[model samples]
Structure formats: structure tokens, C-alpha cells
Target: MNERFNKLRQYNTSGLGCWVSLIIFALIVGKIGLGGVVSGFLILIALFFLVPVIGFWGFQWWLKQKITQAQCPVCEYEFTGLKNTEFNCPSCGESLRVEGDRFTRMTPPGTIDVDAVEVSVQRIEEEN
Candidate 1:
């Protein structure tokens, strides 16, 4: 899951760069004009802005879905609001690191306990 997230992030970043370049190109074209095709030029300008707005919104929505589905490894807490790399456990007050689908606790060097920490897999619901 981490690998998949990384891939998606990379793709989004590349796409944003492409969109920026296209915006620049559109500006240049608009300034120069295309043999007096004013309507077509206006349409191109609208698309130049529209495409990036849609892409950004879609990317944010997808990220929100992934964050909501994340489960804490220590307290089994499902994250509900904003997504971030680090979050303090609401139930146990432990600091946890979120990486894709995996959650890890940040513990002191000598306080590690193998048996006390309970690790459980979250069950997925099946549709009938």
C-alpha cells in the first residue's frame, strides 16, 4: 500500500508540473493569437484553468478516502479529520507514524515491550 501511495503521489506531482507548463503555453498562445480565432482562443484559456482545478480537486478527494480508511496500529483508532504523517494516539496518547496503510509507534529505546502491544488486523466488510 505504501508503494502504491508513493506511485500515486509521484504521478500527481508529475501531472501538476505538466499542467503548469501547459498553462504557460496557453498564455503564450493567447498573447500571440491563432490567425484571429478569438472564440477558440477563449475556449483554450478556459480549459487551461479548468483542467488543473479538476485534477487538484480529484487528487485531494482521493487522498481523503485513503486517510479515512487508515487504522492506528497501537490503539486501533480510525483517523477521522485531516491526514498527516504523524498523529498522537487519541486513546493512548502515544505518538504514531503513518505511512500508507501501516502505522508504527515511536517509542523510547528501552521501553519496547513485545507482548504488551496488541496488533490486530482490521476486518474488511464484504458486500452481498
Candidate 2:
């Protein structure tokens, strides 16, 4: 989970870097009077925003690929969602906790046991 989060973070950082550089490049071109060319200006505008948007969407898809479904230890209910520190069981209403890649049932009163059962990761089929 941490690895996936780090990968997404790196993607976001790179996207931001690209956006900044493109903005700078656009500013330089505008200062040099290339902005007078409508086509060049339009292309620059598109690149200044479009590249980061595409990158963000691609990273989102990658992040979704890394997520796997986890079963509720208390109710055996399966759930497909992002990794979170805590979540409620859909079937039993039990609070569930996540540590690293492991999902376990949280004890009542908000306490986590040392011997919590480990939830298995269910494989997700990729769509074309």
C-alpha cells in the first residue's frame, strides 16, 4: 500500500513539475512575441494544461490497478476500495482497520487486538 501511495505521489510530483516547466516555457514564448501566432499560442496553452491532466488520469488508473478487495474478518463480506486506516464493515457494521497491506477487524470501543485475523487479497479482473 505504501509503495503504491509513493508511486502515485511521485507521479503527481512529476506532473506538477511538467506543468511548471510548460508554464515557464509559455511565458518565455509570450515574452518573445511568439504569442502573436494564434496557432502556436493555442498549442502552447493546450500543452500547458493537457499534459498534466492526462498524466493525472493515467496515474489514477495505475492506482486503481494496485488496489485489491479485502474481506471483512467479522462478517466475511468482501469490499473493493482504496487502502484506508479505518473503515466500517458493510455487512456487520464492525469497524475495520488497515495496517500496511493487512486488514483486520477492530474491536468494539475502538481498540485493535494484537492477534487480529489477516484478510486475504482478492484478485481483480482487468477490463479491456
Candidate 3:
């Protein structure tokens, strides 16, 4: 039941805590000189906006690194795609499926037709 609360307990800092801390710090520094207040304000803005923006782009770069490159099995045309993706080969127009670092022909969807003999069911009276 405690799992509901302690789900790894991630730091959910959305920069507001820094803003509050800087406001208090800035007010103290503001007593010293106007320059200190201005510098604190600049630092607060940089931390609030620039930090998250840089982190977002950095995460995107990390994820893009995982999207591997593969080649079309039929035409040998190389391309990049996410794992287990199926798409048409851009160079040859052949349907291709990707898995891990390699590519293969996409198997056609739907069940195969099977020829079978039809059987008739008859009801018989059971003797006691």
C-alpha cells in the first residue's frame, strides 16, 4: 500500500523552488546594493527558463541516439527508423520491416486460406 506514495520519490522541481529561494536571497542581497538584486534576478531567470530548455533538448538528443539505422533487405537502401517499425522502402518502394539493426520483408497481414473437408454433425438418441 505504501507503494502508492513512494514510487521512487522523484524530484519534481519545476523551477518554482529556485524562484522562491532566489527571491529570499535576492532580498537579502538587495540590502547590500542594487547590483546584487539585479544579478540575482538574472540568475533566477536563467535557472527558471534556460535550465529546463537545455534539459529538454539534451533528452531529445539522447533518445534520437537510440533510433537505429537499418537497410532495406530487397534493395539494400539504408535508412533510419525506430525499432520494430514497418514501412515502405523509400528507395525501392518495397514494404520492409525493421528489427534491431537489420531489416526484412514485411509479412503480409491476415490469415492464410486452408482447404478443409466439411463435416456434418448428427444428433443421436441416448438409451438409458
Candidate 4:
């Protein structure tokens, strides 16, 4: 569960936070003198950047809490993150079916039919 949350958070930084922080830094340095820059500008920059982090963390926490967890359908083996449409099941090497939150077995053991099994990758949604 922690692993899932961490992975979600790691991939959620979309570079917008850094751009906002940079803008805040530049505005503070240009408008206010050095004495006030650290106090005023840094606070703005930190606050802006912190928003994304907090949002990302909260979203990841929700996915881990609510989403259904499943394993390789064909083989009954547990796995995560299948990037390709066709992948050998980690345990049985048989093609698997991944649809939405559940993985259903499409083929039985000792079967190697490419046309039999279908693997679908679902898009992970971030909770608002």
C-alpha cells in the first residue's frame, strides 16, 4: 500500500510547481530588496510549491485506500504495472486479461494461444 502511494506521488510532479516557485522567486527578488526577499519571496515560493506536494500525497493516499488490487489473471500470480498489451504471466507465462480494477483469467494452464488472452491496461486516476 505504501509502495503504491509513493509511486503515485513520485510521478505526480509535473514541472508546474517548479515554474511557479521560480516565478515567485523572481518577483520577490525584483520587487523587494534583499532584506525582505528571504522573508517575503521565500515564503511565497515555499507555499506555492507545497500545494502540489500536498495534493499529490493526498491523491495517492486515496488510490491506495479505495482502488481494487488484483494479480495476474491467467496465472493467479501477483504483479503490478504491465506496460505492454502482450506480456507473459510471471508465474505461468500464459497471456492474462487486465480490465479496469480486476484481472480475469482468459486461458487455462499449458495453453500458449496468442489470440486467446487479452491484456488491457487501465489508466490510474488521481482522487480530487
Candidate 5:
């Protein structure tokens, strides 16, 4: 996943979707109890579109903010905002795009690099 998306994941990890869904279900049940089938159905129909659309858009905005705040390690160029596609650094002419579990431009030459150190820590912890 991209570092930008990772940031969004941080924001949304509290399970906002699940909470909203539960609330909607509760509201639907309440409407059914008070106003009968017709009223319940009407509210459900409105919420069906409103809840998911707003939730998705909010998540998108959060993700976009994360993308914009990221700086290219090679060039130190700041992204504008809401990048719908991959971006390259403007200063050093290096790719700022993240790939898989690794940061492309940020990786170093030696085996004692950050990634290697993380792997070493995991390996040692697992052994213990």
C-alpha cells in the first residue's frame, strides 16, 4: 500500500463504518416500530445512499490529505493535494511513488538498511 493510503488507514482504523452501519440499523428498527413499513422503507432508502456515499467521500478526503502531506525522500518535493494517480518528485527527478512493502526511492544500498533491521528484529523476536 502507498504511504499516503497508510495514513488514511490510520485515520479509519477506529471502525467508523461499522459504527455507522449499526446506527443506521438501529434507526431503521426504530422507524419500523413507530411509523410502520412504509415509513421505515422510506428512511432506509434515503439512508442507503446517504450513509455509504458520505462515508466513502470522507475516507477519500482523508486519504488525499495524507498523500498531499507526503514528501519525496530523494527530492524533498511536497505533493500538491488529492493525487488521483502516481506522482514523481519535482526537485530531484526521482519517483515518489511507493511500491508494495518498500519505499522505492528511500531504500539504501547496504544490507543494514532499515528494512533489513526490521526483518532482523522480527526474526530475533520470533526466535525468542
Candidate 6:
């Protein structure tokens, strides 16, 4: 019946808490009267706490823009990686390059296959 919490979400929108804090602050000031010790202290708190909260929110937004989820084309493995970079898929060990939202299969450099294993007599004795 309540429209306030109809949406199923883990958290509210960004900066909602700060806005609520400011509103509660105004309510407290209204009740206690203006130009008093309590109002001055509340204003000081809003300056120190609210400003940094807003700044950190902006930093978080910037970080989201620079990093994103990348899916491996060969194995369809999803992972978090920086935008426009190459990394091996943890699931399949396949080299993949991420460009924007696109995942491209890339060939790893300087990888050589061994035809045989050569072991010395001392090495074989140590293994046994």
C-alpha cells in the first residue's frame, strides 16, 4: 500500500542519504529556532560531513566510468577489468582484449609448446 518502497533494490539512489540528512537538519533548526548554538553546530556538521560525502560519490561515479564488466568471447566468462586492456580469462586461460563493451579473443605472445621433456639422471633420481 506504501509507494515509498515499491521498488525492489538493495540500496537507495546516490546522495539520497545526504539529502535526507539536510532535511532532518532543517527540521531540527526549525524546532530549536535559528541563530543558536544548536543550529551553528548542525551547520558545522553539514559542512564537514556532507561536503565529503558528495565528493566521494562523485569519485565513485568516475571510477564506474573507467572500469566495467568484460566477458570472454571464447569461454563467455565474465570478469571485472579496466576498459581497453588485455587480460587472460580466469576460467579458460584464453587471452582476451576488452574495448568498451566488446570482448575480442587475442593471441598470447611468446608462448611455445614443448615436444618432449628432457630430464637429467640426478633430476629423475630426485623425483623418485
The lowest-lDDT stretch of 10 consecutive residues in candidate 6 is 119-128
lDDT of 3 by residue, 10-124 (tens): 6677998999998988778767787877888999998999999999999999878668687777677888876667778889998777776787776666836355789899999
In the range 1-128, model 4's lDDT, one tens digit per residue, is: 68888877775559989999999888878887677976876899999999999999999987675554468754567775433244556787765555676665566679674647678999999999
TM-score of each: 0.43, 0.43, 0.44, 0.36, 0.33, 0.45
Q: What does candidate 3 score in Cα RMSD to the true structure?
A: 19.4
38-117: candidate 2 lDDT, tens digit per residue: 76779899999999999999999989765658787776788864676577877888877865565677666766555668
Candidate 5 CA-lDDT value: 0.63
1 or 3, which is superior by TM-score? 3
Instruction: For residue 48, give model 6's deviation from the true position in Å.
Output: 1.2
Q: Which numbered prediction scores highest in lDDT against the true structure?
A: 3
What are the per-model numbers of colliding residue pairs?
A: 0, 0, 0, 0, 0, 0
lDDT tens digits, residue span 23-76, model 6: 987987787776775668889988998999999999999889878786777668
All candidates' lDDT scores? 0.74, 0.76, 0.79, 0.70, 0.63, 0.78
In Å, residue 45's CA in model 1 sits off its true spot by 5.3
Clash number for model 6? 0
Q: Clashing pairs in model 5?
A: none
Task: Answer with 1 or 2, whichever has the higher TM-score.
Answer: 2
lDDT of 1 by residue, 1-128 (tens): 68888876764365788899889878867887665557778889999999999999999989776674556676687764344567787777778876655677877788865657678999999999
The TM-score, computed over Cα atoms with residue i paired to residue i, of candidate 6 is 0.45
Candidates sorted by lDDT, best first? 3, 6, 2, 1, 4, 5
